[model samples]
Target: MSNKATHASGASSDGAELRRRNVPGESNGSAVPTQAEVDNKKSHKPKSQSSILSTLDEYEFLIAPLIFTFLAFFTRMYKIGLSDIVTWDEAHFGKFGSHYIKREFYFDVHPPLGKMLVGLSGVLAGYNGSFEFKSGEKYPEELNYTFMRLFNSAFGAVCVPLAYYTARELNFRRPAVWLVTLMVLFENSYATISRFILLDSMLLCFTFTTVLCWARFHRLRHESFSVEWFTWLFLTGISIGCVCSVKWVGMFGTALVGFYTIEDLWNKFGDLKMPKVELASHVSARVVGLIIIPVLVYMFTFWVHFLVLENSGPGDAQMSSLFQANLRGTEVGKDSPLEIAYGSRATLKNMGYGGGLLHSHVQTYPEGSQQQQVTCYHHKDANNDWFFYPNRNKPLYNPEEPIEYVGDKDIIRLIHSQTGRNLHSHTVSAPVTKADYEVSSYGNTTVGDEKDHWTVEVVNDAASNDWTKIRTLTTSFRLKHTSLGCYLRAGNVNLPQWGFKQIEVTCVKENKPRDVYTHWNVESHWNERLPASDPGSYKSPFLRDFVHLNVAMMTSNNALVPDPDKQDDLASHFWQWPILNVGLRMCGWDDHIVKYFLLGNPIVYWGSTASLAGFFVLIGWYLVRWQRGYQELKPIEIDQIHYGGIYPVVGWFLHYLPFVAMARVTYVHHYYPALYFAILTMGFMLDWVTRPLARTHKTIEWAIYGVLYVVVISLFILFRAIVFGMEGDNKQWRHLRWFEKWRITD
Candidate 1:
């Protein structure tokens, strides 16, 4: 028969006929199948139904996940109670836990649910005390940082199993499961951060659980909605709520889940022939059970503690109930005064409400403070009134020309007739030499003011008057006030006679012969006068005020300049090593979200980048290869295997990219335990993508395997650079240096 006819008949054949043809063993009177027969049958069968439990025996299949889970557990639990000292935010969280245990419903930036969980752990650790939310006092010294960290570590341990379940839901093969589990085991940040008394590990655990539940929900949709499905959905919701309680960023998971539900609803109802109302009700029921129930579960998990806590007053309890009810009711207002007040009060109380902490105490400068200052070198009397001169200082006056001014020691005046603009009355000091004139304007000019602009004019060696402009006044500018002082303009409009060393006019005045000084000298004098100990001196205030300002300005200027040399220094000094510094620069010194980004959470940034890149690649690969072997690959067989199903392939790629990318950004101090879960998830995805291709084309299978090898090598190099090159000074340059090291290795 022809190949096409053979393929058609092969498709029509029963499993028994296929097995008989494929199996090597003789079927005689109740004899067991031979190993070779089983092997041959398995090889011919599609991979979708080929479980490791059947191929390697159940024992071997079970051992790997168990071993991986144990390793993950050990890594998390080994340093569980070792670090005695609390790091930066640990102290605040510890106090919050104490407060929660004492039943103090004190407001905090984070929801109270996470702290309540920590409080439960604290109680277990023998920290029975009255919680003082403000001073953070009454914390049990016996609990220690290690004990506090243990709770998160244990949660981190739970993540491995959660990851496995998630992978299994996606029908990942044994190899993919193992690869993901192994990747999670070695992820440094997830490991390190999990061992600290912070919310990140807990956040990660909850996020993994949510994803797992979501995946299960997706897989089990073909069956009628059962208690098991509801259970997973509920758990997923609880995890999301728990995450939100720990940090607001947890809401992202909730958003993702909601999106998934909408997609599910669309798929279920889009082609239905039922009435509009019936269809709507059906979709609504699914949404309520899957999406709404989980959200409520999450919210209720947080509300339970608030309701039960003794310190949570009746009003607080009412408010908590109201908030939960609002979420259920879909009353998502754009802004909530209560939430704003709660956040503001919590931050203020935590930081100590002294000095400028109070809103009323914040400094309020006058409106003109926004405008630049303009200083003129005109005469000032004892009362500091302008000295006016009536036409004595003409524009074309010679050095020996006699000048007259109508003025007393108490009052002075000046008149100028250039450009028809009058210097009718002004304060004039003694005659300032060219050098002195330059000094007076130094640093005194506002950024765009011409009087402050300085330029060096090159005069010809032969002629005193023949001078050429060496450089334009693009940045620096200098002015030479002659015997007759010139009227200074604030803008960059040039004086007609002031170019190329042409000394035209000089202003001589009759005030005390004061030494002209540069702005630097004035600043120096201010510094000296204050002597570093004087509280009222300008230097101290200027230093304190201008540091942030200057840093911001320099960073902005550096970005615009595009000088790679400057960028190299800036990146080295401020942008790369301490990822937080880069976040700060990105945020323009805003401490809210930028601070969180810097805390070594790679999923938010790097993971996102990797996911996007991986997604495009997968899409491209699928578009190219999906129909290439249509003649050889039967649709029925494809359905049975479905290893290369589009959904599974996408899921696997997304699942692993986050893990690998996050590992590349992990730091010693902050661990994201979810990376392990991510890796496991990706492995399953890869297995799905590879198995289909493998059955059809060995070359494609090997190509996929080669890609994985390259990915692993690249990840190894990246992790090495992050681990070895970073100096952990929380500066931008260090981060750049770390990046540089990675680039060099690459």
Candidate 2:
């Protein structure tokens, strides 16, 4: 007998009632029962096998998933503040919080909600000044770090629970919900990112929560299109908008929620063949819930800082009202040359750089000239060309010139010493004497022939094998000529193996054979001057000890400006190096922060790509196996629910396209959109995979299921290779294939 006929006859009657009650038990009767009888039987059922397992069938499919979600929450909140250092971006948030609580909203790169939340925490901690939370100070240091990290950790912790609810709402089995929650919890990316002091984790939390709410609404109230569904839809919109305010990447969540709402509306009306009154109400409710509510929520989150703060600055107001401002008027004021030019100013308002335009200008220089001019401000000379002047002559410094002393003497000394060493002493010219030589003794005098006026004697010291020369001479010369010049003269000199040593010289009147005067003994030589003190070596007393102490105190106390240097570093660092700097700033120093929010431990920034590929491969494998199972069941003629319907195909295609596009993008932030799409697609795919199992299966069906599994595995490997190879040197494009080239281009 056919499976459907069997279900209709004999024990199948009770089995149908069991299916209606969604209870697992043996049937004892052979006749079909009334709805009231089935309800009565359900009420009389015993629940002793397992409380938890029984609760799963009694309450809803979501209970087990919710329990699994607690694992993620615990991991995110565990030991969040191991690192005591106040990172660059954390300092910025700390400052924003301080200012915010003081009724002052400062303009920043992002909207106000994140800063407000952080500030609210600081206010709770009784933050006072920049130096209140320093280490070893009056305030508790542990509390300081924990306070700053609390919101991010809490938000991140909730994502696991949100994922569970999302999966359960899609009719996922307990195992699937547990798998997804565990993946979210243990996945290095999700775990690490929860500890950050940045917006990405918060954005993820808000986005995921919004998705969960939408899914719940879909499963429970979507069929009836109730007022409660509209309320949940509004809440979802608010969450999505709040996420977008934190980071623009959260817009992907907004889009997903919007798509789901529209789909919900269409499904409600289309099922009844678009009846006018029913369709109008459905369309109107979706318009209010999805479009109008989300826009309002987005604006509300963006403007809350402005409303709450008393003295919001012009910059703050501009940033908070960015979407409301007139772009063309803002553009006109920014075109002045007096303002600094850097780049296109279109994104500047949204990015919080008002009253400025960024532009690049070319510069040019003439041949053989050391001077250059900015081409925008100065016209180039007629002779200037963009060609290299290989043969152009430039003035060279003469070593003999006095002013040339400023040139590098070290290089000249090296060359000259090497040349002297290479040449023979006999080939060297003898010293020229233009004046008479003189000798003086403290108690006696000695005279020598004019040709032998100078006598040279060489002495060798045991410590050094080098010879030292003593020259005795009668000399007369003016003191001014040689005494104050670059070179010094001396008498009774001692030479070391390295070079010249302590020497002294006496000044005399020209042509006189006697000493006129001396400036004491002149015992020390000018070349042997002691090293001068370098002013640069000196550091401030504040910086050497007190400043860092102050910063520590401030951070610990949850005070404003915990570290001013760190705050400045975030702004300037991001402006200087946008890509790497922004990523690092957002990730923070906490390993958990990068792990949870970025989707993998950013320690291996590329791991997300691999995980993404693996996830898709699993989905593809499951699909192939499901198809194979269907083929095998065909022979048995067992009537089963065919799950791969028009809706599933549409959902999968819509969802997968975004992820495929994301994998090919250059920027990592683009992955958020891909993640949003992939998740929804997986949900739809799961729905398709499970629907067929609702019916009775024969042995042939089970065999087909096994064969399908093998087929899926093979197809996954093949598809993965094609997708991964298309990325080539770009690991980010691992989801794109040659056949899917449009994803890369898009």
Candidate 3:
């Protein structure tokens, strides 16, 4: 009954035949059958194949999934582009797509795949990138954003068929497959969300397809390198790249595939009869398909990203001077510091949480410290400029001189270049993180007292490199206050608008010496009398820029605080997502008729949730009984129930659980990936329950199928206005609010 043996024996027709062809249960892929069972099956075979019930089964199996898939497409596409006004995220993402069309540079937090496709769809549809894409901006009669929405809708439409196929591959019977497909198709929230210019629908499509591809791969495992096997594997890799390109959320798909690959390989390794080289071959092939190919495709999206975006936009402020110089429309200064030296004007960047430039401003923290605020800003600014000076006041000294370089343990003071204030710290508590000391530009004079003296420690040093010597963009350093022993901290916390919304900087000592928050780097160097190179020559290496961009993005994501104006005001927690605790208003909340709200069909949503619980209860009962020796199971049973059913559960958790941990605001749309798995689990449970009964009354299976389908269709009929748009004040909206959390009433 072990899954290892099930995988070994159940995948082959020859292995099943070795047991017996004498009973229907023999080939069920779970257990062997007795002689009586075989005789019973033989008696029923003719009636099951030719009787009225059998005929009904065939029509349902062959026609229902397809019909539901078509319905899913139509329901999603009917007047899909009805709303031309920019919805919540449309202004930003739509504008990003326009930037791509104009070949203009901009920065976004996600991987390039989703936005790149959006931009490509716009270009193909003849959008000229002239729309300003301002939030709440009404679409002009001449401007068409329909094609981009249509592209996402088309992909979103694929989820229904993919669900059907994936369930079918998992051995769910016709009734179960139909239920699964319809559950996805009739979901109200998916219907409304997919029709908008957003990435969620497209991401769900790719995520669902990736799971389906893996199911196909599992089914073809016996074929080795056969066309079906290779094709499924290739498709899985491509979808991983696609999903990952869309958002980092796709990493869960990559993880699901990765974990399954390892398990599959473990099973392969246990096959003693298989040649040893077969394991090597399997690993090598998967490495190519899963790792190398996906990575190349991921990089290719960036290649296209860099290719299309040449002109600089608002994003230039976040990048290094060297990176900005490569962008069009930016003035590149044609000078470099002779060499980093004492009295050199330098921008010291905090290589801490999120990596920001050490910045100061006239604004004060206002509350706790109340001194002039010192913080780390992600963008380039003159406020970030500072002059490096010796801690002990001597007439100016050259710590940057090669012969007399600043080395490790050197005491130094940094003077704010703009305000001529010395960088100083005090015993006052920081405004946000009270335990940490408040760091600010306190003294007016360039000469520093004890509080202004900081010891510079070279981070990446050997016998050859010194701490006192400064290099731009090459070396990293840590500044420790010589008096209090606290290290400079860029905790990646945000300050209020008074501080220009930069990262909060404090002074705190840590138990460990390698705390990343204490590190710093020189971002820009300015000195006269040294040879000047082309502004472009000092640019960080191309590879470094790519790494830097990703690092900056990760840092930004980690520090993302919700903006009331941008994120949905009705953002739901992960717990609320599954039950439809709250619905996001798409647009038009006033008394006007014909409004859109993103809410899922409760029948499908709740059914999926119940199915998730049912899977555990149903599967756990059989598994526990078998494990406890109270019952016996056949290889086919193990294959059908455990091996087949456990995956979607794993996938459901993989997709759903992370949302609970995310710091970013989440909406109901986030549950769609988990919903796919829930639907599959529901289908499998229905199939497992009704399979044996099909030979007898056919009543249990058909009755449940009829009721679920009828309910879903009725819900769809009642909620037609949710997607197509209807008057918000209508009684229909009030009726749709099953719970106060639904917020269906405009």
**lDDT per residue, candidate 2, 1-746, as tens digits?**
53334332212323233232211111111223468986676677654534555465555434554565565655666556555555434656666776666665345656567777777777666665343322222324534656667666787777777776665544443333444454454544455556656565777788777767765565445245556566676777677667766755566566666665666566666676667888788678767766677667656664465455544332332221221122222222122221111110111111111211111122212211111111100111221111100111223333233321101011111001111110001111112111212211111011211111111111211122332310010111112212111111222222121111111122222432222121111000111112222211112132212222222222222212123233342222211111112321232322232111122322122222333344457556656877877343341122111121222223334433444444221234433324433443443333334334434433443454445334433433333322111222333433532323122222
Q: Would you list the C-alpha lDDT of every candidate in the order shown?
A: 0.39, 0.38, 0.74
Q: Is candidate 2 or candidate 3 better by lDDT?
A: 3
For model 3, what is the C-alpha lDDT against the true structure?
0.74
Name the lDDT of candidate 2. 0.38
Give me the runs in candidate 1 sitting further than 4 Å from their true place.
Answer: 1-36, 39-56, 59-62, 129-141, 273-282, 308-364, 368-612, 624-685, 692-746
- How close is every model to the real structure, measured as TM-score? 0.48, 0.46, 0.83
**How good is model 1 by TM-score?**
0.48
Off by over 4 Å in 2: 1-66, 129-143, 220-222, 263-273, 312-353, 357-746
Residue-level lDDT for 211 in candidate 3: 88
Counted clashes in each candidate structure: 43, 38, 17
10 residues in a row with least lDDT, candidate 2: 414-423
Candidate 3 structure, TM-score to reference: 0.83
The residue-by-residue lDDT of candidate 3 on 543-579, one tens digit each, is: 6566666776776776665675464566778988767
RMSD of every prediction: 20.9, 26.6, 5.8
TM-score: the better of candidates 1 and 2: 1
Q: Rank the candidates by lDDT, best first.
A: 3, 1, 2
